[model samples]
Target: MDTPDTPHVNKERIDTMEHLSAAIGVSRPTLSRYFQDPDNVSRTSRERIRKGLERVEYVPNFFATRMNRKSTGMIGVIIPYLNDLFFSRLLEAIERAAMDVGYTVITQCSHSDPAIEARAAETLMSMNVEGALVAPLGNHSDLDVHERLRSRLPFVMVDSRPDTMPEVDFVGTNHYHSTGLATEYLARVGGPPVFLAMPRVNFNAMERERAYIAKMEQLGLEPRIVGVEGVSGAGYFEAHGQAVLEREFSSGRLVASSILCVNDRVAIGALRAAATHGLEAGAMQRGGLRIAGHDDYPLCPYTVPSLTTVAQNVDAIGRTAVARLVESIRAEKSSGKQILKLFDGEMKIRESA
Candidate 1:
């Protein structure tokens, strides 16, 4: 994100569609239909509207238009954080899908605060959004707000969902499948691995941990989880991973030859901890400790020795969420089903494992 050094124009815009219709010799209904969807009008009308829009420097007043309509063609999205690469990619996918359906997206970031999340939901409601796609705060979230969102609009939870509100529609990664896939691969290629966990922050963390333990026990290996509980999952995961592994290393009790980190950030932290201890992380054939994680983060492949992880189907999640939400919006109701729409995670084998 950089500022544009060169400053340019002070152009005037035609605010109301009525004035634009008069200026462009197009009917007001044609202008409205065109703005809603260019295909809604005839080919000749679309061409005329396109050229007319350029001629008048037209900019539709979204707020004013929304005020006059029962359906605003807008969707609200609330996420936990913006700095995480996974979420950033997910947002782009959602934006593209919404655009394809001729809907605008209004996004809000809670910054890991439940109060902020509730406020974001309220703000979206006040904006008169037709539907919402939310990533709730899990145990820390305001269940009342989620209940209200579910009761009122076409709401679908994405990525993470609150434990209490199981009734809401959800779309996210299938943690059991992903964890089992990664754990089994590590067990076959190397040895049974110890799980390095994240804090008990959200549903994803808890689900991943549970899945890892289940997989380990299924393989007849003891499940060992190394993590600090009740800590914040706001940010700085690498620091958390490094601190935990460093302490384990110093005590001389870290005997595991293979480690499965919760996420790539924690695995990156593990790499730092290994470097400090003069240990190497790579494939087992090289006589190195094998380390792997989930969530093929954008920077994982660039890390030292690279990182083997699972890649979430971000596009599928976004597209499915929007499609279902739109269906609910048009139907004026939810499907009233609690079944979570889960997408599979793909295995990404790198030098690390």
Candidate 2:
């Protein structure tokens, strides 16, 4: 179905850019410019091109188009885990924000492997991406690859950061504020909560743990920490939470009636452990253990007693990361000074605490 506003007379043989441009009634240069960035062309011509492109069957050579332009109109985002809903939500928000400003996102999932993480960074660099956003693998990440990307492109870190890169741009939740909020809130309602720590997978684990310890000390309380600390070993997700809690229960070493888990995943596992131990999750008044977690996860509210944790400003995190990265990308040269944007994490009180 051809429209009257456009010059799309051909039903066949529109396989070349030149022919497509002719069919669309635009100059070759304008067509090329439009292909590079639709916003670069005037609205009228852009609409005409859009309408005509649908009629034609010409597929622009993606690599050829990128080779001709200095601006790729593309941003690369490398995430540590694609299966994790939190990262998935963050990625979704990043994509929407990038699209709002007329940019395409190229995503790579690292699968939580150091070699894979390094390779992902290298792949984006090889593609000549205008910029990159990474949710690093913390201690396990290859910093050299990120360093190389930082040298040539506008690079930003999301969620977590490795220790070596002190001057890189980062956008994430305020771990101190988040963990402290949960710790203090739990102490006030119940007794001082024993910290249930996650494996040292990334800087976030330590950040949250230290924040909890600091808050507990500030309250003049003993900070009892449980769970494995060596590395992100065997157990995944809830399994880690469940196993640690079960071990503490068996050992009869877990003190403090209330428990604060590292995150909602661990918290959920702890809840399961409580149920397994014939303990209920609710207020301490019902002879139940008060359990709280960090990062008011998507499933937190749906948990048996609903998890009481801190709410990270995921919207702000995602939007701010893209804005900061885009700003850096547009700069003639990136401002070398490290930029850190930490969004606040508010306490979300629920039945679990």
Candidate 3:
């Protein structure tokens, strides 16, 4: 008897779909159609293919098969930065959603650079991808690159959309409502918090700042905006945040009694700065500053005193973006009607206000 580990025994088994079809007395084309979609084959042929698969343990090479077709069966996912936990988590969710439908995800990070973003678009276009989901670089993006690509393929914009691409499909959180939610909560429990703005790198930040100003005005309070200057790139939020806070403290301008950061990263930076100055942060800490942020990032719960934040439905965003793109790809035409899907944010009140 041949043992399972015997080399010759393994070599005798069918390894490819062509060999398996020959062994099962079925045509190779029939087997290929079944592999593409089992429902496409007749019941008798499907049963035969299933039996053959059980005997040989053959797994089809998806890439090799896709190369022969016009559609690559690949979806491109583009983001500004992968090191940021927000984008990384969003990418993972998008990948999961795409794989569930038998499509592969090709991810590219722009590193917050417009030139690199344009290059990434060109690469995806050259790949002949079935569709693409892009989280654009906001104001810094090249509109011509996106316009040319969208003219030829189906693309869904995730998170941020360029103003020039108003006709494109979009999936994102409602920044205005979410920011208002956070601002209102902070004002209700603590003194009206000052808005700690990050450098205006993206539309999301600008929306948050606008929302903060609007909410403060509605409450009949003066809106104080302290922005971090001369900072860009990943991991700069905390450092610039700390520097901005230090300046505010020394200048006696940190008078709001609380600080609402543009995002969780900036809030974390402010927390670090407050700690360095021997000032405690959180609602329960007396004589300390109340701090809050947006996005409810992965690390928010583990912060020194935890964090209060507005949590965007990232999973929903990813799933919706993929679904929309897939629909467009199936339609094979860019619909003149543009669709916008926005998910709401939930406020989580923690120890930090």
Work out the TM-score per prediction. 0.86, 0.88, 0.86
C-alpha lDDT of candidate 3 relative to the true structure: 0.84
Order the numbered candidates by lDDT, best leading: 2, 3, 1
Better of 1 and 2 by lDDT: 2
- The candidate that wins on TM-score is 2
RMSD of candidates 1 onward, in order: 4.8, 4.0, 3.4
Against the reference, the lDDT scores of all candidates come to 0.84, 0.84, 0.84
Residue-by-residue lDDT tens digits, candidate 2, 55-126: 777888887788689787889999988778888789989999999997889999889898998888888888
Task: At residue 99, give the lDDT of candidate 3.
Answer: 91
Clashing pairs in 2: none
What order do candidates take by TM-score, descending? 2, 1, 3
Q: 209-258, model 3: which lDDT tens digit per residue?
A: 98899999998999988874644433467777777787777666663378
Distance from true location, Cα of 306 in model 1, Å: 0.7
lDDT of 3 at 43: 99
Candidate 1 displacement at residue 1 in angstroms = 28
Worst 10 residues of 1 by lDDT: 228-237
Q: Write the per-residue lDDT of candidate 1 for residues 39-144, one digit (tens) a residue.
A: 9899999998888766567777777776567689899999988878988989999999999998999999988889999999999999999999998876888888
